[model samples]
Target: SAKHSDLCERRNIYADEKSSLESELDKNLVQRKNELEMTLIDARIMESETLVENESFDLELIDKRIASFRQLLEEKDAKIDELVKQQTDQKELLDKLRAAEDKQMDIINVEAKTSRKIAIKLETIEKKHNECLRKLSKMGTIPSDCDNNYHNMSLKDEYLELQKCKHKLSKMPSVNQKALDQLTEGREKGRILQLEKREIKAGYESIQRLIETLEHQKYEKIQVTYKSVSKFFVEIFQRLVPEGKAFIDMVYKDSADSGSAGSQASGSHASQESQSSGGISGAGLTPTFAQIDNFIGVRIRVAFTGKTVVKEMNQLSGGQKSIVALAFIFAIQRCDPPPFYLFDEVDQALDPFYRKALADLIKEMSRSSQFISTTFRPELLGSAQKFFGVKFAKRVMILENICVKLISDCNMN
Candidate 1:
């Protein structure tokens, strides 16, 4: 009986322990499920927050870009407006220039016509003067104007003036005996005055003739000098540049005023003249002495290379311009050479060929004239007979004659 009781009690204890263990496991599973749910909800909230923050950042960046683009567009528009205003101003300036050009043309035409008329009158006066001189020469010994020196008178003019004076004095009251004597004295003085007037007129005419003669002589001298200088320029240019052709030409104020360019201007005088006249077809308004008449300015025409078109001195390179100037000096020296020419680094801008040519030319002409030149060119050194150098000692610069061998050494130092 005691053993049965102990067995029942043990069975009851095992049932309670199994039930309690099952309840504990069910509570743990429920708690674990609640924690998982809470964690998933927190993760979703964090994801949504991150998405909202990302969107806000993107919107701010886009707004900034749009503002920058708007500013850039405004700047471009302002630039465009400024350009348009400049263009308008340029157009207005061009129109004003055109109007001024037309006015200048009309004035030039009027002046040209006046010049022609004056020339015709001069010719007529010259003929009359010659005839009068021939008649007077055949008549007696030439009267000396020194006896009665008067200025600016004519015999015919004096007679007319005397008549007018007599008419004015005729209305005066009758004169007394003393007044008669005074009138007689006045008449004698008038006769002497007429003789003086004749002498003065003759003297004035002689002076006029002398002026005309001198003017002709001046024109001839100008022509001769131009020809000689032009010839020398051609020779020197040929020596310097065998293939290059260059020339000096007179640039007329009228041609520039007319705003005309020569038609078909090449390396010839005829072409240059046509260009100077602006190829005016109908009026033939070109002057015969247009090139030589006005001594306004001179221009240089050159082609540095054989194949290039001829250009003005203003169009040449710095080196080429220096070469041209050197050639001009050579021409002047050959024309009216001085005792000695002082040159300061004359070969600085010269090319090798030009330097050699210049040295050779100088050596050739050295016998006629002396050249005191300063140069670093070996060509000039080879041709030189004397050299000079400067020494700096104790802050003092001293000039001394240096030997040919020492020149290079001093330069190196």
Candidate 2:
């Protein structure tokens, strides 16, 4: 019995242990089922949120597409409206053009009818004129044998003037037919002579006035030119020679006025002399032309170095004279600048310093005018833009760059 009791106790203990283990396993299975259900719930919620977001984005995109389509429709509607307006304007213009065409047709028809009536009236007038001419011819009273009136008919003013003259002549004093005939020839001749004399006198007066006008213009031009050239002369001379200045002194025999008494007297004297001598070509007039028609003359005055007083041409040295001559040429050129200039050793007589000044002057002047200079000085050659030397052999020209050929070619020429 003790054995049996011990065995029962053990079995009971085992049964308790089995029941505890089964309870622990049931708790674990319940916890695991709850975790799985939570996981499935989370996944389902995420999928639903994702689907809602996607639908929202798709709806927004669809709304944007619809807005774009609506905008395109609006643009098309505006274009259609503009086209409709243009069509309406074109139709109105077409209607106006048709109305103008009808009005023009009416005016053309009226003008055509008026032209036909004028043509008929002209024909009737021509027939009456022919009949009048025939009757006048039969009576031997027609002033002109040829009775052509077509040209006169077109010239209403001339025809009216002829009619007035005829009326006046008819009202004049009567005279013996034979005496009137004799006086008519003399009167016509006298009238013609008188007209010729009047014409000659008028022509002479016109020519005299023209000559006076031309002389006045020439005087003014000379005064202006002299002033310009003189100013340039002084400037150029001073520039070429730092301590020198030059000027052109103008000497006039009279007041330099075309209407001056001295001028008139001189002109009259010249005319009388020319006539008396038969021709000015054969006259013993000086070939110098230093008189300038006895109107004016020019004298060059220059001063160099310590000489402050202006000296005449004979007073200057050779170098000073060359400088003065170059200055004069440049002065005249400035007044009427040419396209180009040709100078042959213009600085030959100039000192080294003056030669440099001449080169600078040429360079400055070349800004406005081109210069071609044959120069021996290195000072001028330095300022040259292009240097070319010429050689002549058998009349053939050979060009080289700044060499002895320069002098040789010039000697040949």
lDDT agreement with native, every candidate: 0.74, 0.73
Worst 10 residues of 2 by lDDT: 278-287
| Steric clashes per prediction | 1, 0
lDDT of 1: 0.74
Task: For candidate 2, write residues 1-413 as lDDT tens digits.
Answer: 99999999999999999999889878997788889999999999999999999999999999999999999999999999999999999999999999999999999999999999999999999999999887554433334533464444557865686688668757864734245445777899999999999999999999999987887677667657766776777778879877764545454454454444553344434433433432131121322333334546665666675356556687788988898888888888888899999988888888988898998999998988899988766777767777786789898999877555554454355
Candidate 2: where are CA atoms >4 Å away?
1-182, 252-293, 389-398, 402-413
Top lDDT: which candidate number?
A: 1
> Which pairs clash (backbone N, Cα, C closer than 3 Å) in model 2?
none
Ten-residue region with minimum lDDT total, candidate 1: 278-287
Top TM-score model: 1
